[model samples]
Target: MTATVAAPDKTRRLVFPFTAIVGQAEMKLALLLNVIDPKIGGVMIMGDRGTGKSTTIRALADLLPEIDVVAGDPFNSDPQDPELMSDEIREQIAQDLPITITQKKVPMVDLPLGATEDRVCGTIDIEKALSEGVKAFEPGLLAKANRGILYVDEVNLLDDHLVDVLLDSAASGWNTVEREGISIRHPARFVLVGSGNPEEGELRPQLLDRFGMHAEIHTVKEPNLRVQIVEQRAAFDQEPQLFSQKYQQEQIELQEQLIQAQKVLPEVYLDYELRLKISQVCSELDVDGLRGDIVTNRAAKALAAFEYRAVVTVDDIRRVITLCLRHRLRKDPLESIDSGYKVQKVFDRVFGLES
Candidate 1:
């Protein structure tokens, strides 16, 4: 008998395609909505280690379309989006605009596990003035994320102050700088995608509400599935180009689905009963505030649109309720997952899902 040797794994050489990722249905849905309705805020994935949480998000940038942006701006705002312009700049655009544009990939700028406050938020250009006697406002990660996705892995571990900066900028859609006698404003609107292992610490409730959806991803332990994953991944490591070529068709098909979904999303209808059900479920669960209602509606509408449905339904809402409510649930003094599962069970009874 002859023994064959196996090739080494090389998952880091290239980003795995978003379409190629398996499982984590809610996570996938939330991200899809971020693309369809950037106003739904951002997707937050909280889960266990080795669950493919980060991989799914990193791969998403691959499926998005290239955007047209102003030629000189670091924040890649759409030349046409009004938020991109200052009042004066808006006037200039209004007055027979001289808007120069170029198409670029929608960015998925990563906030490293540990980054300084000054670097994450823009700071004044002291070096420019000290050396050349000229003042400048250097952009930061927040600025570059405009009209893109700002991704933070291990988000719960981020400094509280930095988290505040992110939330405020996200809510306002622009960064305000007031330091070193240089005050400036620029577009900072971007979907904030945060992924973390929940065992470390819980994200603040106020901050949690800001995320439009939350998905809990767990590792796949199935024997057959795991075997396939390892084999395909090892094959790709031995032949990168050939592997990507094989999935080229799959990527194209997924991209087409996304584009078609985007077109229909604007016209997708939210039914009256669905709206009532959303309110009822939120109240039943005793979840705080109105963001829950808003996110539930948005996620359901987006899910329907993704599935090529023309109208929202209970099924759509049920699929996304956990994603919208898991992080926003009021804290229990006892500390348990029951509060979350209880809400989900209530939703099932009211909305008619598998009990």
Candidate 2:
């Protein structure tokens, strides 16, 4: 699953290392699990502004190992996997033509707030197609994000319709564009990561529920930890290369760990009793749909895999259940209780853990 790409340009800017991030453990854990199993859907991170949300996500994308892609293909087409290939690549395969393979860093696409339907989903040149007798298609952000990560900052502020389009593509692993009866479909299997400041606004419950996991973060309050984070940032800014070098080994180790976890994920399993308990907790929480149950199960298994285990443990479920179910619980304007706390209380009761 890992590929080796050409050496990075020395002049390129260095990202803050993921392993070097100060705190926000919950956010980091949710992001890692999603990477391990994109089928778990994606993670919605709600936090205060300047809480390292964007920093951590960018570091994660930089942390991931390179991937194999078809040379000259805009979609990062996986030459060997049809599910991740573009229509043009499939046709080339059908003709039994040779494919040129290349390696590149996993793409990380930032979805802007003002992005239009055509900007995100690409456009079809109907006139060009009709006149030239060919498919005149321009690839979009979704195409560039294929087999990579699609990041939406301030997702809560994004238009609901745009959010729907992103979620639909994330879930279905494909994007279709139709214009003047000319249709084009391409693979768009990417981990959808969205981060926002809760103070701004909240996404519709329906759209929020579609995200696989939700991580809530706050500004670091500990003086020592805050000082350390600030110092680290200052150091990185002063000597980017030297600072990055200090944590290069840890980054490499984490990259290897993520790759191993992804490979081990398919073998990881959750017990039947645990499955029932997960559902029971969801039932008690009155979650609107089965998404909470499904995401919890998937995230627990992913955690087990991350730890190099084939069987899920209570600790695994305990760690991820809140992130998986917190946003799914119905909201009450008059109730001030934290949704995560409510989820934990229900989990402990259903799993027979002492409160």
Candidate 3:
């Protein structure tokens, strides 16, 4: 009898298409909205382990178009956006040196659980300093993720100090490193995506409020849908290249839609009536800070951009309330209602179901 050998896994051959993912419509929408307008801050996705949380992030990264960057730039600074460039980088350009320009995939940096402060924010280059007696800086995960996405899986399990570092950078868009009397500051702006299971632990309120949107995903409960998901996974495992090829058209269409949304985003307008409505909704929910009101308005405008609409409609505001307000809700120990439910109730009362 001949022994059957298993085929080698070709997971590297292709990534699962963003458009091909099954279910989790809300999660997908939240991600896409941020992609269209990164000023929405970022998104936190909470759910079960096997419910495509990490996969959704990888697929979204793949779905995005490549970005043009200055060659050999550690921060991936945009050639067009000088404000985001480092002082060293600016000096090179000032000398009339020919900067090599190239296109690369948008960075998707993962902050592992055991990552140290030095590893994350980078430390001085000891080798260079020892060899030449010169002070030199080393780039870290935060620098690599500039103008891209920084993803943290199982974020709630991370150490509080590290979480504080991430939150500070996310809030200020600048990562300042001071060591041995030397200081370096650079642009650290990037979209933050955090995912974890709620049962494991809870995120700090201060860190949680930094995210512009929050989404909860769950396992597919329908038998037919589960079967379909399983079958698709099996097929992809068997022939990764072939499966990706099948979804090529769909992926292209989705990418085109994202590009269109970005172009249309600036044109989309938020009217006075809708602004009043957003304020009322936030007031009714009794959310603590003004972040809720600001995020809600940004989310509504993003939805309008995605739909290629120049005006914000009531439906657009309604669609984004839960995503924007879920994490910002005040904790009520005596009331065991879902945050999304509270948002919906307030939304219905303020806008009316007919509106």
| lDDT (tens digit, per residue) of candidate 1 on 1-355 | 1122232344544667776666677788888887887778888888888777767777788668767776665777566678765444466667865656667768888998688877888788877866886557777898888888899998999987888888788878888887766677787888898888879987888887888887777777788877777777687678867877777888888778888888898899998877998899888878888888998888788888888999987777777788888777778788755655877788888878754
Model 3 TM-score on a 0 to 1 scale = 0.93
lDDT string for model 2 (204-309, tens) is 9999999999999999999999999999999999998999999999999999999999999999988999999999999999999798899999999999989999
Error of 2 at 345 (Å): 0.3
Alpha-carbon RMSD, each predicted model: 8.5, 2.1, 7.3
Every model's TM-score: 0.87, 0.97, 0.93
Pairs of residues clashing in candidate 1: 214-323
lDDT of 3 by residue, 126-167 (tens): 677768887688889999999888999999999989988887
Question: Against the true structure, candidate 1 has what lDDT?
Answer: 0.78
TM-score of 1: 0.87
Judge candidate 2 at residue 78 and give its lDDT: 95
Indicate whether candidate 2 or candidate 3 has the larger lDDT: 2
Best by TM-score: 2
Clashes by residue pair, model 3: none
Candidate of highest lDDT: 2
Model 2, residue 41: what's the lDDT? 94
Off by over 4 Å in 3: 1-12, 125-134
Model 3 sits at a Cα RMSD from the real structure of 7.3
lDDT by candidate, in order shown: 0.78, 0.92, 0.87
